[model samples]
Target: MDIDHLTEITANELTAAQYFHGHKCPAMPQGLRAGHLAMDFLSVKRARGGSELQAIVEIGDHHFSGCFADGVQYATGCTFGKGNITKRGLGKFALTLIDPAAGRAVRVTAKYERMKMCLEMPFFEQRRQGIPPYALDPAVVDPLIDDVVNRQWRDMFEVQTFNHYPVEPARESFEAVECAECKEMVVLPYARELEEQRYCAVCYQARVFRGQASGI
Candidate 1:
């Protein structure tokens, strides 16, 4: 496939994404294509950090074997660390890219036929049988990867344009509070307030679990 026409991302970026993701599976490339398409359509630069762009992904917990969200993150720069990418868990291979300042947005989704074709591949059969992509024979896996990489972008996804997608304001400030149980300072956004006391996520979950176990 002509990688140049696929997206604006460089060869190095793709390679780095693969390296970080630890595989050359199709889902990552698919995500890369989606991200690039979104940015291109919105006429926006990749988010370096902060809330320059936001990606709302529709990938579910275990629907696809590949880490599709990772692909979107790599291509769009809307990473979890930066707090820009969110999973809607609609159980569909789709995402919405939003440009808050421009008031523009678009939803890109894998075409049903294309998704069916992918699922019908021999590689997907292996996945359905509980075989990991890396565990499969390279001979079988390489061809699948090649097909995904080489396929025309027009053949893969349908883009639905929208004006005025609700873009929430970026949280620029946070209150620091002490976790009552741990007595450690935590960002308010990351802390849970219960019964007039704040607890970190870890501590909150532990407390909830302990309460449940003891019939509290």
Candidate 2:
């Protein structure tokens, strides 16, 4: 379906997205638009499982951008649980959704002007004043969310399509081992060796630290 029709279909998805997101904010819906546009441009559906789609987001572990990633996660279905979301720690509002099977990708970035306008709003003014987003009045927040969700696609993002973008398929791990020390299951690739025994990363590090402290 075209992006517009798809967006119209998303009327119900927004409620679910908001529920998963734990409080309403504009950034998440802003990300919703971005992810929707990327998939629409690439002609791909919301990824189902096992890396059918990968969303590489430039937003990082920050105060402002975390919600944006949540939006992208909800919209693209490229989630941490699915292990399809990759964070670049770039601290910018950008998303690159890659369909490696098709050798295609599209990058979407929030427009600077729109971002600037959001920053100047009373909602953010309260944000900068140390009020949590959920604490603000819906009256103060709903208008921004409505505007972002209803805004024209072209006005919201700068989108670029990549006919061919290099993407390596992520390998899945089914093999697991129990750490000799922690007795906890760990994926094979993450198991560390200590004295010919399998160990999880945490237990392995603890052993290493003990050895160093005792001059082993």
Candidate 3:
């Protein structure tokens, strides 16, 4: 499982990741690099619509670098639709990639010192000025992505690995039932029962269930 992280990832792989990510930015590629590193270290293959691996991203909503998770998903094949990715809501850019079957995991973070260089780049300056990354000029964004993809992992990331990482195995549900309110099919475990009528969480009178609204 000792492959050179620098050489193992290909340009085509990053291109696919960028396409899946739908924009060019350093944070996403930083995530791509980190995920590639973790997978290589663990000697694991990318998941194919299954929970072969899991990603816990320390990133909160409405913050910078949240795009990192997309990169991780592209590289490791852990995705929300597959129920293999989770957010820690810690408002940071870090990935804990896990191979549950092997009990192996690697936590990767872009080094703050190096990341500051990225933040100071002109690309981020435009981002700070209320311009969306996708709308930014390619000249501004492309250079930053190039820097991220070409940088050495030692300069870019901090990696902490575990051989005996503890993981709660995922429970896959195949059974579904109709919601009493919206009438949509929801997984049996995710269905909520209130007054003996099952409904999906969204239609379950959430405020009432939480004792905040009337009709509990």
Residue range 92-208, candidate 1, lDDT tens digits: 888899998887898998899988888888878888899887788878777766666667767888988889788898886568888999899898788997777789998999998
Question: Can you list the residue pairs that collide in candidate 3?
Answer: none
Q: What's the residue-level lDDT of 81 in candidate 3?
A: 91
lDDT of 2 by residue, 36-149 (tens): 888888888999996789999997675674699988999999999889998999889999999889999999999999888889999989988999988999999999889988
Which of candidates 2 and 3 reaches a greater TM-score? 2
lDDT (tens digit, per residue) of candidate 3 on 114-213? 8677778888788999999999999988877887788778888888999999999998999999998788999999998887889898888663557655
Enumerate residue pairs that collide in model 2.
none
lDDT of 3: 0.84
Best by lDDT: 2
Ranking by lDDT: 2, 3, 1
| Ranking of all candidate structures by their TM-score, best first | 2, 3, 1
Backbone clash total, candidate 3: 0
